[model samples]
Target: MFKTSLDKFTSINRIAVISDSALGFGSPDIIGLADGLCAHFGAKGILVQPDDLNRPLVDINFTADVRSVRLFSDLPTYTRSWRWNFFRLAARAVDEFKPDIVVVVGPNGYGASRALRHRPKLLVYYMLEMATTEPLYADLHKHYGNADIDAYIIPDIERHNIDFGNLHWRKDVDFEGIYLTAPINYPVPIKPRAADDRNGKSIYFGHIHPEETLLDNMLTPQLNDCEIEFFGRIGDADRGVIANRIASTPGKAYRGLQTPEDLADTLPRFNFSLVTWKPEGHIGRFHLPATKLYHSVLAGVPIIAVPNPLNVYFIRKLGIGLLMDGWSRRSFIESIQAAKAMIGSDAYRSMVDRCRVAAEGEFAWSRQVSRCAALVERALEKKWRRLYGPRKSQPALAANG
Candidate 1:
């Protein structure tokens, strides 16, 4: 199906993906992009990441070869000196692969620079967060400014405008960037549940920060009518606290970490997915796009999100979900109440229909693959002209000759 997507760029063969987080560990975009490129172009690639022995390795069902490099230490150190060692190890793997394009995921300054040393035809940076206030990100911005990146891929344009617009690097006249949200594996077949069959169940996945997300406050008796499920990673400190809270709640459960494949089967069983974020600090202000939004839609389920501009924009644009009016616990309760009321209504069914439509079109990862290919083609064209000047017209005397 994707055979024609890269017909214009046949010269492009192999790709290299470098990231601090390993595939299926924390970086879903990296996994999707690498897998999509392989499926689209029928290209071979290599994935190089730091080996985290603490976490079990996830089996990523992709075409690329995986290489894990052990970092000097895993003690949450962001110092350039420490990261440089990782870069050195990762670069060796990348060098051996000899990719035509190098895509660096996340804010790894030394790693990005090291990848550039390979002098691939195209260098792409995929920004994971817009937390400019963080010292590590600020330091990495310096490396990003100096690196000769051919293109950039961000989660969405709103986050870029809010957090990265003022950066000097983004102002370059030649800068090329694309905003892609978390993509759903296509052909998943969205099957919206019938109204009569619906139950008042909701889900919250990804990081499970009890206090930061006000999830602790929302788990009271007021929301006893709805059943909520929690999944994904949690800090060691908060695990016991969150587990106790879930246990005390009448209809709450913590299902622990499940793979994306497993969640694909589980998501459709819920009526809505909760897209909550802390209403303050860098996370709140930047409001990075939530992967759950697409995940919900892909399963023919709607979402109930807090009042973040990006989330609100998509919810309104697609009419696939509801947004809370405020960040207080009362607002959270009200939003759930609102969703519960709409569960069996025509509006709710319409939302489900919209999700199916979106999953088949906009939310599909295949669409992002096409756009990514197009961006690479554009970059390759510019590179060709820069190396060997634009094609010249032949003399006009062919007929006369």
Candidate 2:
């Protein structure tokens, strides 16, 4: 069945993934998706992105042959034409690669539009971030429409509706809800931490913004019994504030940024994973259950999250985590206490079992890759028929032709 399913992807011989972010060492989502596509399709994949850091072109194998094209490092930082220059360079790269499919990640609609000028067989816009404001949404709509992207891959269905529901061109294009899940590289049959060994420590990983304020709340004396570790990037301006908070608090500690492998190994040591956000504004309003949620599950750790709709829905459905009653410091403390109580119980064991089950089953990226392949295949078939009429055999076509 697996081999048969992948047979359809043979027509897609080469794929070009263009993104605004760096490749190989950038967003885990981009890297994971690119890897999954390469593995599933057995295609040569080229990742094109701006050389913001001037990194050398390198090949990082995930499953199939994958290479990076770093462009536009010599342009002046203050120049307004960098975006246009990037689009031109990216289009030239896509033309040279002549990939059967082009998957654009990030908010680089104009770049994707330029790639269209080269006439890729299929153009897909993979939206990794939410359109936080109306102006941004309008801008994305304008550029994406101009790009004439064939499909969209949004992280979550709820997020798709919240972010792109009003998009006028949405119905005209194919779209799929692929959750931002953990890569399949995490070790399987996750050993659940013993109740006694949990040690009341929880974890919060990913980019830390001072505006969230939940970390600061966790430092209060009321929550001292429950230790929490912070990981991932922090801006220079907020570093002092967070460092001081961690220093002053007995149980709170700021561990430096962790690689994905390190994170996978480290997450299981904690009692719980924190997935809370301030319940206001764009982030609070439509925040989806992201990498943190799946990472925690894969590590066999239950999530203690705020009552965001997607988080609440998944937590209740999976039975792998708990949701706080509200987004207050008191509610946060209460949730930690609740998690602490369940630490050594059979209930906690059940939750851990659920996490392991989920990690290997629905939440895994392997399944998502299959879904993605099918979506791309469908888009290709439709495009093939529309462009050249129905055919008995679908042959690979030059994307630039």
Candidate 3:
């Protein structure tokens, strides 16, 4: 209905994005941000990868008009042929999306040059995990080269600078920030269950994929008085490794993944939410953008995140959550102990309350998107000047083509 009402208007600028709609912990949170943004700005948002067989894909309530122009929404599929089909699809999207900006999720896209070639557009890449740790510099240079590209958005910028010594040659990467795509206001969850609400146990949430052995090695060894509860599913390798570690511990159990709606009710009951188990190298250290953090922040739950680049920046900037450094089972135990102690104290509850207040005031979707409109305008600067007036050059690169 909204799209129908707006048909009288010309097609607005489109943004072609390449990303994995992973549904990492099962929050289609980002899509809400995209939909909200498009509606607010009167622009078109095409999310490239939410249509995959992956369970708990980014499911969100969208306005009448919502679409993700996809590549390979599945990370496994994207990784398998990182060099193959994605390039072709990316180049094709350039021609098809007629976008003002092209957002690429990067480990290195093979066809970036092809996509951006001869187009007056900006290419925004979210260097979440790969900008820091990928081994193939040659391929990355090829992708980041000045063909059709423009700017970058990273989750791990501080580490990307420190670990890589320079991010894409110390280029202008926007670590200044990215917002979680969640609703501005959420319905408060039902009061947590008294049975589940206890500092007697700690809960760790997320999927267990084998590639993250860095996480496994860090969290497994502690046999302590602190009872640990595990939620979310594990792939085979993670199952073998994680199951073996928890076998003897009566308090450790895997409850599989739950929806964000479920977490709103479930998370508040836990003594504390464990943010992560690893903080090694660039990948482990810098790339931990768990949706859990947002939920915890919003729910006013005390969280335990590792002191990676993003978290450190978030901690300093937000002053909301707590962090642990290094992978020592000792550090893990200590932090959990500290969190447990804090949970029992008024000080910690106060900290949680403060964070929730911050979320409501600053991080809410409606408020956060105001900046994205400027980002879109930056990408379309030249176009707005040409088409809409001196201030209205449309950035839709393929418009004339």
Task: Show where candidate 1 strays beyond 4 Å.
Answer: 1-10, 63-82, 131-133, 143-147, 162-166, 173-199, 283-285, 391-401
RMSD for all candidates, in order, please. Answer: 5.5, 7.1, 7.9
lDDT of 2 by residue, 266-315 (tens): 77899899986675566424465557787778778889988888788888
TM-score of model 3 relative to the true fold? 0.72
* Clash pairs detected, candidate 2: none
Q: Local distance difference test, per candidate?
A: 0.68, 0.71, 0.55
What's the distance in Å from true for residue 367, model 3?
Answer: 3.9
Of 2 and 3, which scores higher on lDDT?
A: 2
List the candidates' TM-scores in order. Answer: 0.85, 0.84, 0.72
Give the alpha carbon lDDT tens digit for every residue of 35-128 in model 3.
Answer: 6556765667766553345554444445726575545544454354554455666566666667655666555342443444435355555554
Model 2 segments beyond 4 Å from truth? 1-10, 23-26, 52-61, 72-82, 131-137, 143-147, 165-167, 184-199, 283-285, 390-401
Alpha-carbon RMSD, candidate 2: 7.1
Ranking by TM-score: 1, 2, 3
- Where's the lowest-lDDT run of ten residues in candidate 3? 184-193
